[model samples]
Target: MSAGSHTNEIPRHRVLAKVEGPLKPGYETILTPDALLFLADLERRFGRARRNMLEYRQDRQERFDYGELPDFLPETAHIRNAMWEVAPIPPALRDRRVEITGPVDRKMMINALNSGAKMFMADFEDANSPSWANIIEGQINMYDFARDQLSYTDTARGKDYKLNDEIATMLVRPRGWHLEEAHITVDGRPMSASLCDFGLHIFHNGKILAEKGIGPFYYLPKLESHKEARLWNDVFNFAQTFIG
Candidate 1:
């Protein structure tokens, strides 16, 4: 839907993603039929809630602009004060003394993965330009990275690049819920950029990474409230069950 469009009028049916941009060479592997369908499923399931949350964010910002101050919600104080422990840190992420982050371009991915840092975060959010070429190619680069098949050659400099033997553990940072992937639409509405980035990565590489003893990890960005965080947690749960 365009800005200010009616959200409730949208129909729920067979979910599909129509590519609105040029499908370049080597993109078919990343934008595979199955992958697109998986993305559609994600959008169909959670896209509306994401948009609602974004609306709430805007409304909250407007309130702040009108001199409203923030405060902790008393309604959830019980949970906050309750003693709880987070899940144990996975072995691959335990020693993160040095973590490097970079955009998802081929050269950058190869360089960062080999940068000797304990963790390398491939950022698809603010660090990346959301051009059609960049978005699609980023998926391809990550797909290859997970499978240990990524390589690049600088034809100008005649320099070949490849992953080092002792490379950093990889994590992905998807775009926040506020953004839309305008290049792909489902039910005549653009899919969430967050879903596009996270869905594609998890669809293509989640199983592969799980087999490697470290499940797919992510650095979620720009969450406004716990509701948004819960949305992500729900997405994670749904994707896990769907993929399994």
Candidate 2:
């Protein structure tokens, strides 16, 4: 085999057992117990499924994979650091893959982490009371988990973290610059509900992640074209230099 090539088949692990949750209104149950058993047997004929992160690493190396993306910034790979103080990500993300879900602030975050997802963005900007205090508190709760996994420190903005036991693939979505009105109160009171999962996870290189030396955020909606992406990247890069 040539370098970076392997012919051996990797071991497979079945998710195994039956797990069920409630069906939402109007949705039909597609598989019965007998059907599930049959499907398992049918899968046995093929093989177990093993996830391989290296597959993704290989694609990234070959320039064969990326998110819904476009052209990259100059010296994109030559990036000195993730440089949240400089920028979180570039237009490269438009060419890479992006996954979206609500900010998991409560212990529900623990469930999402255990479910095998690769990344989590605890949402303060768009998932909690839009009050600055609430946003800061929710972020603290997330750092409760972060502190166990990595060494992080930033007391100025009241952000510090360390990590342990699956620190969680995570990012954070701040209130979208355009959509803060979606949750921010007019009288400056906390929102009756809270921010929904609508904003992108934009980090201005807070004292938390700056302590850890890692940075990235999921670009949320309103990003309609590459020019817009370039603009967002520039904004993040500029913001992170001081905050990050």
* TM-scores for every predicted model: 0.91, 0.38
For model 1, the superposed segments whose C-alpha errors exceed 4 Å read 1-12
| lDDT, each prediction | 0.90, 0.39
Q: State the lDDT of candidate 1 residue by residue for 145-215, as single tens digits.
A: 88889999999999999998888998899998888999999888989999999999999999999999766
Q: Which ten residues in a row have the lowest lDDT in candidate 2?
A: 192-201
Model 1 earns a TM-score of: 0.91
For residue 228, what is the lDDT in candidate 2? 40
Candidate 1 clashing pairs, residues 3+ apart or interchain:
1-189
Question: Mind giving the per-residue lDDT tens digits that candidate 2 earns over 155-210?
Answer: 68776443335434555664543343222222222221112221111221244544
Minimal lDDT window, size 10, model 1: 7-16
